[model samples]
Target: MFTRFRLASTLAEFLGTAALVLIALVLSEITPVSYFVATSLAITLAAIVFIFGPISGAHFNPAITFGMWTARRIGTLRATAYVAAQMLGGLGAWQLYQYLNDKAVPAQSVTFNTTIWLAEAVGAFVLALGITAAISRAVDSLQWAVTAGATYFVGIMIASTASAGYLNPAVAVGLRSWNAAYVLGPLVGALVAVNLYHLLFSPSAVPVKRKR
Candidate 1:
């Protein structure tokens, strides 16, 4: 895992993340499916995890990459490379989305307020928590899928009145939007999650493998 994958895991991360943002961009705007943002994300993300979870850990979000790095499950350089790949993937999706739609994607910054900030923070925190737990233990991939999907669902529902449910900074780039709430909330949440897990659940410094 020393940037020495002959298969080039960074490329894999690029492709995997591009696919995820593409699914969200295209599917979430198409009427019936658009109404079910959580459903679309859950299904697409579950499939992605099944396929790329082993390859690049399917970390399509910077927050997830940051969480893994904080937990020492990945080296700093690998994590940085993965994050770059994710941002590129997001950018690609946003470009394609704009081209296909023939219109500018809406700017989606959240209104700043304590309540809104907390909403975004809590949503991101829950997602980071589930992702960290899934990686930490011998949980089923299917279960991981459900837990992650549900976390998104719950988070979105809770923050419905506030943030745009960006939950990920990389995904924000893919969607062609940036909000301080979206960025800071997820970063804080993911950082807390990795540290909290080690402090309370597993104090051992041993890193979890990517495939798990």
Candidate 2:
């Protein structure tokens, strides 16, 4: 059994992630939304922040979780729980996608070229930086929104290749049941991104007391 905060946070992560995947999947399926994919993800992330940021920080992405943990912003126990919840949420999203669509949704082919990997790394680092800065209050609320918008633009643009720009492993898991190939490289890429961000930006590559 989990504590109240942990339970609530897990549920929030699950629902929020599910909604994000659903919206992205639905939108991408209808029209050629690949162009606007960045905007769509940004909107989803913003809404998640509005809804669950106060609760669980709306991680939804394992890379972010891992990065934060590595940066010493989160405790070991809490980080473990967050990672588990994120994985479950991603699996749930995939299942729900199947249930709603009445078929395994065809996943887009995402590949890994050096350029693509670099793009993913950069995207992940930028997104993580934005998130960390926001959490640390280094950036104001308005700055958070601006950061989200810019991060999404950069992220989508970077990952707009055969690989659907997976900057997080949780996202890869969500898409894995549909397309497994998109999982591996992006996970590595995202981890690299987070490590780079920590090395460059964090005071120490260790956890500190989180603001919230």
Candidate 3:
């Protein structure tokens, strides 16, 4: 499987991530729907996972790609490709959202403070860990859904104060196109969160029995 990285799978990863970013931008721009944006994101995540889980592991996020890479679920080269795909996919999504909504500039904001940055870091850590756990089968579908829903809910709640609780660095980069100046605080926070998550919940640290 490591030697074979099919174009279909690669594009699927791109499409899945693209769809998610598109929905997120639309929700953030068309409506200040707040937590509803989180719900939409969660729904998109579930859809992506269900559709592309078997193919490319449906990572769609760089943090997740890092977590899985560290966990030995994927190789370094594939991880790099996956991250590239996710970033490009997110950018593509934003562009498409702009085209559809007829809005040249996406609704962009960066309200960063120490506490807010910490909140973003912690939120991102939890979100990545939750995604890892779900994909790892550490939790059942019901629990996975709950965890994902709650993560987005909490992320959205703290968003206005924390650069919209963006948990993915790739996402931050994607948002940067709309505004040339992107906030560094949340970006650093997100990277720190993923690394911390690896330290806390990496597979080597948290062993499990093989499924029969």
Candidate 4:
């Protein structure tokens, strides 16, 4: 049940997600800089959140969308649509990266362990927590941009050793071809984060006066 106007929101998500993948893919191909490329991701995500927040809430990641869904910020069907659009963005980025990098970044099969999985979950939780705060108390695009940027900077620094730091499911599917850790860990973390936000910080409902 997408109205024509809502389609723009989907497109915004697509562009933002694809931009992240493209930037990450390109940065990863650079020598030496690839080792500490979280800055690139942080800057790009910050810019996207600032530019596209009004259009789509600047989700750009399925985990964030799922977090919002769990927190009842978005309806289920709309969240599904957003997720679909995000996957497409990832697919587009992967194809573009393959073409540009000559398939240099093939998806590797990971030997998953508890520690890596926990890293993904914890990173995603913190990332989602930042997103929740940005949405809940955002004064302007600048605040959201800062929050998203900081989350990526810290989260990637931690998660990179553990899971290649695919905190965004869009990146997991698009860049890493859907490894189990990339797929499940972030979603679980998003669920936990959203629930925690709901319990601890989300604004409570107020009773309304009935018709007089």
CA lDDT of each candidate? 0.73, 0.67, 0.64, 0.82
Error of 4 at 80 (Å): 0.7
Candidate 4: count of backbone clashes, pairs at least 3 residues apart or interchain: 0
| Number of colliding residue pairs in each model | 1, 8, 0, 0
TM-score of 3: 0.74
lDDT of 1 at 137: 68
Could you give candidate 3's per-residue lDDT for residues 94-175 as a string of tens digits?
Answer: 7776677786744455444566556555666566656665666555555665665566566556654555666665566555
2 or 4, which is superior by lDDT? 4
**Weakest 10 consecutive residues, lDDT, candidate 4?**
27-36
Misplaced by over 4 Å in model 2 are: 107-115, 138-146, 177-212
User: Which pairs clash in model 2?
Assistant: 72-206, 72-207, 72-208, 109-162, 110-162, 110-163, 111-162, 111-163
For model 2, residues 1-212, the per-residue Cα lDDT tens digits are 57898889878877877777666666656756556777777887777776677788757777777777776767888888887877787778878888988988665554445665555666666676667656655445556656655675677666665446656666766766334334444455445655665676555554687897
TM-score of model 2 vs. true structure: 0.77
Candidate 1: the clashing residue pairs are 90-174
| Residues forming the 10-long window of minimal summed lDDT in candidate 3 | 177-186
When 1 and 4 are scored with TM-score, the better candidate is 4
Model 3 misplaced stretches (Cα beyond 4 Å):
1-5, 106-113, 138-150, 158-161, 177-212
Which has the higher lDDT value, candidate number 2 or candidate number 3?
Answer: 2
Per-model C-alpha RMSD? 5.2, 5.3, 4.5, 4.4
Model number with the top lDDT: 4
